[model samples]
Target: MKRTWFTHPEPLDTTTANELIQRYTSRQIQTKKTLAFDPKFWLVSALLPEYRHEPKPSKQYQNSIWSQ
Candidate 1:
């Protein structure tokens, strides 16, 4: 954890890490059913990038309303 992006005031020991993971896992269990069956979920996200080609933004795009 040395030279990482974030600096924690906390000392992250094994027990604290396990507790954090359990909290996250509990949240996912509550939301998993809804996200898994949604049409605009991971499947479309994964496939769209492969099948669709998008134009790269030019310098002019910086001032365009679309950028906003």
Candidate 2:
């Protein structure tokens, strides 16, 4: 089967683009388990903003070090 990739026109920094690509790649890998074909996964992702690229504190720890 033919495969196609789509990207938005909004300029993405290298980090943001890499994160988005990783998300898409993982989704594609998970699709292999599905019994039926679905395009909604990719569609929804495309519509959503790439917010995952931002650096955030780890949930496992607090910012005590930085608070000093």
Candidate 3:
């Protein structure tokens, strides 16, 4: 994984890249919000259910959760 992308570089695709970035950012925001709301165990809030199944964040943080 380390420096491997340099050997087999991924093709440039801004559309796909943008979508992936947005989804990743959205999940990160959700994870942060979940932990903030509970402040309990951390890994439980991130995984164990699946990355795509992260607990939904509050409305204030949800505006950016799913891509428009």
How many clashes show up per model?
Answer: 0, 0, 0
Candidate 3: where is the Cα deviation over 4 Å? 1-9, 29-68
Best by TM-score: 2
Superpose all Cα atoms of candidate 2 onto the true structure and report the RMSD in Å to 1 decimal: 13.1
Writing each residue's lDDT as its tens digit, candidate 2 over 31-68 gives 11111134223321242333435677686766778769
What are the runs in model 2 whose C-alpha is more than 4 Å off?
Answer: 1-5, 29-68
Clashes of 2: 0
Query: Which stretches in model 1 have alpha-carbon errors above 4 Å?
Result: 1-11, 29-68
State the local distance difference test value for candidate 1: 0.35
lDDT of 1 by residue, 1-68 (tens): 12212222343444554465466456552111112233333211110122244577579537677667
Q: Give the TM-score of candidate 3.
A: 0.27
lDDT of 3 by residue, 1-68 (tens): 11111111233244544454456467662221112233332221112122444477668756565957
